[model samples]
Target: MNLSILYRGPLSSCNYACPYCPFAKRRETPAELAYDRRCLERFVSWVATRTGDSIGVLFTPWGEALIRKWYQSALVTLSSLPHVRKAAIQTNLSCQLDWVDACDKAKLALWCTFHPGETSRERFLAQCRVLLQRGVRFSVGVVGLKEHLAEIEALRRELPAEVYLWVNAYKRQREYYTPEMIADLTRIDPLFPLNNTFHASRGHSCRAGASVIAVDGEGTIRRCHFIPTPIGNIYDPNFADSLYERPCTNDTCGCHIGYVHLDRLKLYDTFGDGVLERIPYGFGESKPFLENLSHAHLSTE
Candidate 1:
């Protein structure tokens, strides 16, 4: 069974300056701004019609999602859907507490990340408390590094037990994991061990075109949000089927959204083994990487 229905959209502007994040420079345009609500409504309606097991829908944004003007309408629309049991948001936790309260009201689990340069540890913990009191199931996402260990530990203690805490490995822009980084994270947070078990293993074997779906601001169904890749328009008649058949050819597919989707699909080996072998030497475009991986697969056969 898959932890399916990852409804990720890049529909916000961030205030952080994280050097390692791929979407660090993301910003929404005027045209893109108005499309999120419509796309989200259509997407949720489509998801509700699907008869399936419990699915988790993640509203992961490139920037601080709470700051987006259309965030509330999108949240209300997605949360109100009948089929979605678990709806979550991945945010920087830099927004005001009211947004946390809104998330709580909508029964959306909050996944907040702690960035030293963006927000202080104290403030992050305070927001955690707000989420807890509001009856929201939440987690603190710690960037896996020695320097952030103390703060993560402190937050673990200060926050409630139900507020699940996890440690995430540091991902530099457009780069996959090194064995060294994995080793380091294993050493740091043993209880919350985070291996690049999702995308690092799966690589280009993404079934995003087949089953997973992401909608951009213009109501277009994209393969994944990391690149400006679109497979079909959600407004089309065969949108779901169209997205379910998209493919990826990325060099290293350990991106957060891609990896999360991989993990949801329980395709860790597809991410890990594929990533290590498929990533080509040339720097530009994913086609060459796909070609190389195809050759490697043919040779194995």
Candidate 2:
């Protein structure tokens, strides 16, 4: 079955200690690093076997993932696959950009998060320049925090107008963003309102479980990160059959990746094919990959 999978590796080590995040910078033990490498390789091998089936994969690691050499190699490997319409990852953009030269930039995209104090703004912007020069499709984003308002606004000014800049709602500081603040952020990221709050998802028809899902390093697949019940195993032959429509069990779904599948949200109207890759889908652009996936979804229905 054609699927969109978010794979979060077991790597818990990060290089940044942002106050907003729990899993801060920590050193990974030699043994732990080895184990993580094995798990990631297993996932890569499994994905290779699914070459005939359409699959869009996003690596959502608990910690910074791009720092690992294997992860870099994996991104290049996945992008080269014909069936992999989208192979993207969430990163802090702290790593070197030279590795991207090996990737199929057409299928590769980055959901980059810019932390104000954690990284040097100049260095981050320089890396962004590399992506633009290489013609890589990517999106720039920052956490929506009151303290970071000025930095975000300044970033928006320096960033290219055509590039999509997203604002992620900070979970711990939900009350920090007032309506006026949202308006300011919205000016930089037109899609800011969508991320400002969680939507009621209970009993609503969502394509989450049936079309998109989360896969842990162990290959265990879940409907979403918030929902931990293992619906199937990614490596298992029966994995494809595990996909089916199910109502959200939670009251409100906040995660962009999860809520985007909610049919009622009509996120498709805004995101279009870009939802899968975390890039803006311009109305005038040709979404051939998404066009193919639409036909696939219709056939399955």
Candidate 3:
């Protein structure tokens, strides 16, 4: 399959401050969110012309896209690209429920992450109903944990047949799954599969060095979210020419970004057993990244 895009940004507000969430303690900054918009536009436009109609785009942000005013416009911009034949967003089903009509206007495929404690089954179902009415495609994901397994199963049954419901392993909080919980998850959607590998059982190496690239809230390309290594700048005039040649410099990676980078190295050591050490020779340079660039490497699809 061609590289699919997984685009994310920091959220403006978080209803539930999950301890494991990276942005859990982060407060929303409208100014930073707005800057993210400009950086996103520049990155997308550059990708369109450089890659040119060969990839699918997945729209996602750290918090929730609907919480920011620029998200709707960002969706509009992404849909305008011909290379962006497919578009999806990972959300918490909070604000989008209120603006289902606006989401439909953006021609996006919605990927809703349901938090049972913070979101109610009735409210989630209401949003699903609205999405179906708008003719927008969507799916539901429940964080896999002993606490939410039952609720996840109920949501799966409650979702429309056309909408797929899957379970996401709760990585930040490592909790054992009871046999009952496993049985419950298996019964919810027998064919249910996780789309994100970050929380999945680790084994695969990632090809992010050559294929995956990300631009941060600024416009610079970095290695991955887990590592703070800078590679190139999407906003730079020469970005298109240098996008694929950037190098990886991370020593330890738990997220999918690390997996992709390691995968590209053809280092298929199993989880907790791979070449988890950084290059002793360094990243080869210590030049300053552009002041306007702050984004990390956008992982390869």
Q: Highest TM-score among the candidates is held by which one?
A: 2
In what order do the candidates fall by lDDT, top score first? 2, 1, 3
Query: Candidate 1 has what TM-score?
Result: 0.65
Report lDDT per candidate: 0.54, 0.82, 0.53
lDDT of 3 by residue, 59-106 (tens): 556766666556665665665666555555667767644444544344
TM-score for all predictions? 0.65, 0.92, 0.67
What global local distance difference test value does model 2 have?
0.82
Better of 1 and 2 by lDDT: 2
Judging by TM-score, tell me the better candidate of 1 and 2: 2
Candidate 1 structure quality by residue, lDDT tens digits, 58-162: 676666776664565555555666555556667777766564444425447666777866677788788777766777655566776556656666766766544
Tens digits of lDDT, candidate 2, 205-241: 8887788889988999899888889999988888878
Runs of candidate 3 exceeding 4 Å displacement: 1-3, 10-12, 16-26, 44-51, 96-107, 172-175, 189-205, 240-301
What ranking emerges by TM-score with the best candidate at the front? 2, 3, 1
Better of 1 and 3 by lDDT: 1
Candidate 3: Cα lDDT at 265 = 29
